[model samples]
Target: MNTNNKRIKKGKVKKKKRIRISRLILVLVVLLVIFAGAGNLYYKSASKAVNDKSTKSVLIEVPNGSSVKKVAKILKEKDLIKNKSVFISNVKGNEKAKHLKAGKYKLAQNMDNNAIIEKLIKGEVYQDGVKLTIPEGMLSTEIVNKLVSQKFGDREKFVKLYRSPKEFSSKFSFLKDSRISTLEGFLFPSTYYIKKGETEKQIFEKMLLEFQKEYDKKVKSLVEKNKLNLYDTVIMASIVEKEAVNDSDRDIVAGIFYNRLDKKMKLQSDAVLQYGLPERKSRVLYSDLKVETPYNLYLHEGLPPTPIASPGIKSLIAAANPKKTDYLYFVTNVDGKNSYSTTFEEHSKNAKKYHQERNDLLKENSSEKNKTGNDENDNKEKSKEKTTN
Candidate 1:
């Protein structure tokens, strides 16, 4: 009876061990299957293109304050990436994901996850709009012509909109109690990418917004400390922008203007006369100076009726904070550097010397141009003769 009981217990133990081994093998197979499926899905997502059939490009604008998840969703919605989940995962793992910038991105449907992620991280946006470069010291009329030439906007429309008191008055506080009715010297100079359907008002607003942004705490503090109003500072800065040869000379020129203003002397600037002229000249003629216009500083005692041209930030800063100097006059030398003078006699001597050198350079340039023209004519004649032969 004892031997039978022991045999039964041994059988039960062996049977329980076999059942446990079977359960362990089943669990291992299930885990192996899950891992294999997960690996395959990852490989496909990382390597597969979003749309291999479509080759068309699309413009996607990531809003100014967008998150990474928002960006991934945007790319996914535009069909520029394969999977939003995979893109989010990749961006999460990337250390440079935080540097993604918000802008209009030109993307194609054939890009893979990795390629799209790379472009997003690097801010590789597409530029489909007209890239208009508004150079410093350009008047409103000149700026309008530039935009018209690029076919970005209508000249009359731009001028009308720019000069409209109702359009910008509410937004820019500086426009209130302003001297000039037109937006002449207020438009900040920079490269703007104007979209195909972007309006003139939108473009002008962007420029004005940039100017407002630049006139931050530091610039406002300087303006206040100098005891000068914003309007006068901008007007003087515009003149400084045109007169100064370089950034270093801007403050000195501003100081000279201030000294002249203090002593009731005429601010005889050639650039102001040029602005008043019917047609701009490379050199200001004697008659150009005598022409009566509100912008003519030679005739006017104070600043012109308005700012003659737009001033950059450096010139604006210089106007607000002028360098202290006794020198009241300046002239451009042969090397285009300023020659400062404390008296009229010194300024006259420097002017005579530099003007002669400038005349010589002009003559040399004319000769070179004539020589080049003759060479081109000779080449054309030779080509014609060969063709006839």
Candidate 2:
């Protein structure tokens, strides 16, 4: 009876052990299947197009300082990526994605993660154009120099295009004025993306078009109501652009210039004198003021024949609507602040103070330079004596 009972118990234990092993195998198989499905899904998502149904090209600007995380967010925002985490993880896993270059890339939504990473790494900037930035108060020569530096074109060719803008003069109404010799003020200082193989003429036309767009109906009405011509307005604006470093002071400087013009007084602006020179100087000397060019406000009255530099919209608006002030004279201080006065005596005093301060700075700089030269000479002499010994 006891043997039979023990055998029954052993049989039950064996059955229970087998059942547990079977259940464990079943669970393992289920887990493997789930993992395989998940792996397959991830692989498909990473390898396939972000949106195979849509084919829209978007301009993606990767600025100077962009991180992978930031780029992933940008891509997500542009609908170029379905999942940010997946894209980021894929990029982090890849070796080539680490060397992404900064540029304006033309990306399409149909591109996959791997394709986009490859494009970024290769820096294959879709060649729509290169960007050129021209700041306000930049002269034609300065613009040409910038173009040359950027390898846009030859300097001589660009200068020729600037000097003789024959085609543009006829095509555009604002340029039809015969006195408009050069496209100095009309270049419209702003950022421009010029297409590859575009001529200097085409680029200038684009800039002029931008200027025309900015000078809308309201601005034109302002010019008409102010009893001012476009050419003169641009000229005054150019002077104002060079004169006023501060935005708030632009209107005041414009007012002062208008007052001088109204009184038939010579607009003795140092900027105008600098414009007359072939090479602009750091400082306008007493002798430089004596230059007898048409652009020289010191030697002649009224506005210059042409705009000295490109004037931004603020300067243009200031010229169109000058502040109502009796102040006729203005001088820039050593700290680059402008002091305005109605009386000549006050103007002279301000000018004297700034000029003396400037002269002192100049003398101090010269003394430092001399000391450096002397130190260099002494070192050389000591070296020579040591060598001789």
Candidate 3:
């Protein structure tokens, strides 16, 4: 009887131990479920929009080389996100987090973390509705005037910004040259859509970026092959832009200038002289030639200090790859045709012929005007006689 009681007690103890173990496991499972639910709720709440019903838009800047943590901080400071930790976690999970670009972004309060992250990753920067068209061969001052006329930027600010090329040199490699003191010939002329509230520096950078693209495509290789100075080539192209009346004449004009440079002769470009004048004129006079400016090619044997104007792609190409020619002199006739000459004597003859032709045409037009006036007077006199009769 004693042995049977011992076995029954041992069985009861074993059953109790098993029941305790099962209860502990059940409690742990319930606790785990509760904690998981809480964690999921916290994640959803943290990742939710800051203001789902808000319609306000905020402009934020994500500066260059900003880390994910910095970006999250910027978002949190801007009130565009509900939680910085959640934002950082979300961005870290995304594969495109590394591609987040720096720029001004237009974000709305209603945007969620995912929406903003996607925008930053895709680099959808803020842009305005204003469209600006900068024409080729326009001076930098003229470009600024156009921008100012459109109420896009301040004149004084643009002037100061363009004069300081070093401010932009780090971003634009072409501006890295030490000799480039001003952003005169570098601003590429193209139609641009100005961003809303963009600074003058940003606006100029847009044009410079366009110039870089064009220079690489159209003129870079040719410039390299010819072993010419990039700045001087631009200066030559600017002269060609002003002097050439037609597309066909650009290459020839560029060649003539090159020949003169090789011979160490004066360029004697009227366009260069005209650029130095206070006001532009239809004809550059003998008195205008005496203007003692560095830009006066009549006095200077080499190119002017800076480009006279912005050059188009055609003029740039022509300067980089000019036509091979023996002719060094050219004159524009009254009919708008250019005559090329290899000798000064031939050039003088051509100039005299064109001058005489222009004078004769002017005299003929004056005589025709006088004849018409006299005929009108005669008709009035006949009418007066008829009235007397």
Candidate 4:
């Protein structure tokens, strides 16, 4: 009886082990069947989406750490792919699933699954709206700098196309045989649309044309009246542009400077000395004034060899139509508001007032720099070095 009982228990144990093994094998076969169906579905759906013809600028954003499944969902939502489940299955089967990068991608409707994967990996046609804004009051060098930084063209190319008379004159008739030394004051300052593959010549012409369009009618006549060259009007306009901060002040400042020019007296403008160099301290030192350059109004009797900066329409008109004033001297307060004087004595008093304000600015700037942990001394040294050079 005991032997029979033992045999029965052994048989029960053997049967239980076989049942467990069968269940595991059954689960594996079921999984294999599911995987095979998924593969077929992926191929079919991916093919259908690839042949679809309704995608218009459909964009998919693949984020960082995204799996193949996540990318498929994005593509489906963007209508770049017909079915997410199949697309994901196909992508998960790919060995190169790790290669899909993070970016905004524009996928064409006619793309195959392979092509869509390649395009996403390549990061094609993202935001597409990169712009370059050339603000008013920039010099030719400054404009070139902006172009080089903004990708309109490079600096050397800009200089060659716009600066070289021989190169520029071939396309622009106005520049042919023109004795203008530099292209400083000629470029019109406004926000411009820059397309890819735009040449340096195209940019120059468009900017120059904009300038011509903004040219005042009276300015053309005034250029004739003064017997002044284009270079002269532009040069004076540049100074007027820098000097006049506001429209009301523009005509008066233009008149004062014009009076000085007509009388052959030194224009005595600190701004001209500061131009073409870096910004200055609150007050220009005697040392700063001693650096010799034609742009220096303190040293040079007349206007600079070229325009100091680009001028606005108001400045241009003011250069043409100067006010009639006996005022020989003008001084601005700390806030750039000014009081004019006819005599040297009255001018001296106003100068003293601004001088005090300038000294205050120096102190305030120093304190601000210290409190903020800024390199005030280094900036001063750099400005000093730049101006001297």
Candidate 5:
């Protein structure tokens, strides 16, 4: 009884141990397969997310009547997704492969594989979206910031180029130091669509081309009539652009600036002072008069060295053909929108009034901007005002 009982117990124990071992092995195999599948899926998803389509393209050009296979190859070439073979397989397996239309596709990083594929097959055509609405009379630095925020170009690089425009002028033969120091006045304010990550060279070419076209359309004939060169036109246009905030005032402001220039009086334009300020100043200080910069129209008998800001079409035309007026002085009034004054005394009184008005406007602007949570920009502007005042 004892031997048989002991043998039965040992057998039962062996059977239980074998069952436990088998269950453990089966669980490990399942876990291994699951982990492998998960790893593969993650790898594919991540690869698709980071791999940008066609150098961060806003559009992917698909030739007309291109086959599914051809589109897959193009996507692969663009580094948009993985496995052209796999993509082709998906398309062929898709219920609508035969209906796959072709055209330009706007794509971005982080678009999943299926989303991009659907967009391409649906003939979604969206070219590089670079909509920029440039205002008249913005400083070069402000322009740079706007461009940088829009992701068209690097702000730091543009700033560096703006600071040293002669280097760029050599590259673009049309511009000289006198006409546009660092391409400031020649940028030609307008709504521009420049591709993101575009090279500085490309952006410059686009802007320069725009300026050239504008000159041809608006100012070329007048330049001939007035015996003015491109340089003079741009310089005058810059002043007009700065002074003429409202569209209707462009011609009238041009008349005033031209009259002052012809009379050999200091332009005494606060706009020029604002433009020339690096750190930004609140008011044009007495010491700012002797700032020894070519842009200091207060010291220079003639025009400032170059345009302070990129001029628009209206300003360009106004520079070429100023309205007939005997007014020697003009001052932007308390609103910072309109002006008041003709004689020196009137101008001085307006300036004094605007001094407080401008300060209040600046402080108001600073508070509003800070309310929008841009304390850094507000502080920078305030610092600029302090330096100017």
Candidate 6:
């Protein structure tokens, strides 16, 4: 009876152990399932696009020496990535991430991380057209040089085309003005994406079209209301673009020029004098102002015969609608800030103050340079003395 009872007890113990093992196995299986689902959800979220339905192309430039983290930040900022951490992890995991090139890339919002990484690694940069960025206040000759350097057209052909606005007058009505001889200010300074096989003439036409659009949008109504022709307004805008250092200053400078114009006072713009010179210098000498040219505002009473350089849209708007002020004269300081004055005596005082400040700055710079040279010589002498000793 005792042996049978002991056997029953052992059998019961074995059954309990089996049941506990089964429960442990079941718990582990459930945990595995939960973990698998969570991992799958994370993968789906990471792999998906920020906007799968949108087809808008965004241009992003990955500058030289940019790391994976920097590129990820750029993508995140551009709203091209769903998660920056996922992007970085994916990039680090991919062997091709090391091969990513620096350039302007045209990426779409529909692209996933894998697609973007592949594109960047393969260096599939935007090459749909030639990029031509003509900055504001560039002289026509400078523009011609830029085009020639880029192998856009022959120098002589570009120069000839630039001088003859009549060539493009048939297409652009703004060029119909009898006074419009050169296409200086009419080139419209802006970034242009020229087609692969476009000619110089077509390029010029594109710029002129842009100019027309901008002028009509921003300056046309104002010019018409002010009883100013497009030619004169563009000329003034060109001058304003060259003179003013900032936007607020642009309007005020335009006003000063208008005031001078109304009073029949000479514009006396150093920029105009510099424009008429054969070559541009860092500093325009007093003698340069005395040189006889239509563009020399000091010598000439009115606007230059042609616009000095390509006037940007802001300058164009400022010229059309100048800020009303009693200021007739302005003198720029060493830091590009202008001091405005309503009387000649006030203008003279401001000019003297700026001139003295500039002179003092120059002397200080010269003194620093001399001290540097003396220190270098002293170091050399000390080295020689030490070697001899």
lDDT of each: 0.81, 0.81, 0.86, 0.72, 0.70, 0.86
* Better by TM-score, candidate 4 or 3: 3
Scored by Cα lDDT, where does model 3 land?
0.86
Give the winner by lDDT: 2 or 5: 2
Question: lDDT of candidate 1 vs native?
Answer: 0.81
Worst 10 residues of 3 by lDDT: 380-389
- Residue 80 alpha-carbon offset, candidate 5, angstroms: 29
Each candidate structure's TM-score, on Cα atoms with residue i matched to residue i, is 0.67, 0.63, 0.62, 0.58, 0.54, 0.64
Error of 3 at 382 (Å): 47
Cα deviation in Å at residue 296, candidate 5? 2.7
Task: Give lDDT: candidate 2, residue 266.
Answer: 84
TM-score of 3: 0.62
Worst ten-residue run, lDDT, model 5? 380-389
Comparing 3 and 4 on lDDT, the stronger one: 3
lDDT of 5 by residue, 1-389 (tens): 79999999999999999999999999999999999999778656544644544356544788888887888778778767676766776676667656666666777655656777677667666645567777877766677788878677777778777666676566566676354547777776676667756787677667777888888887889878978777877777888886766777777787887777788776766677667767676445555656777677766667877677788888888888877777766656665576545676666666566656655665778665455443434543543343332
Measured by TM-score, how close is model 2 to the native structure? 0.63
TM-score attained by model 1: 0.67
lDDT by residue (1-389, candidate 2, tens digit) is 69999999999999999999999999999999999999879876765677787778998988767888888888889888777777887788897776678888888888998888888889887667788999999988888898889888877788888888677877678988889888889988998887788887787888888889887743677898888898899999999999998999998999998898889988877788788887876555555555678877767888988999999999999999899899988777878888888987777677667656765675679775564553444543432322221
Q: Residue 223: error of model 2 in Å?
A: 1.1
List the candidate numbers ranked by lDDT, top first: 6, 3, 2, 1, 4, 5
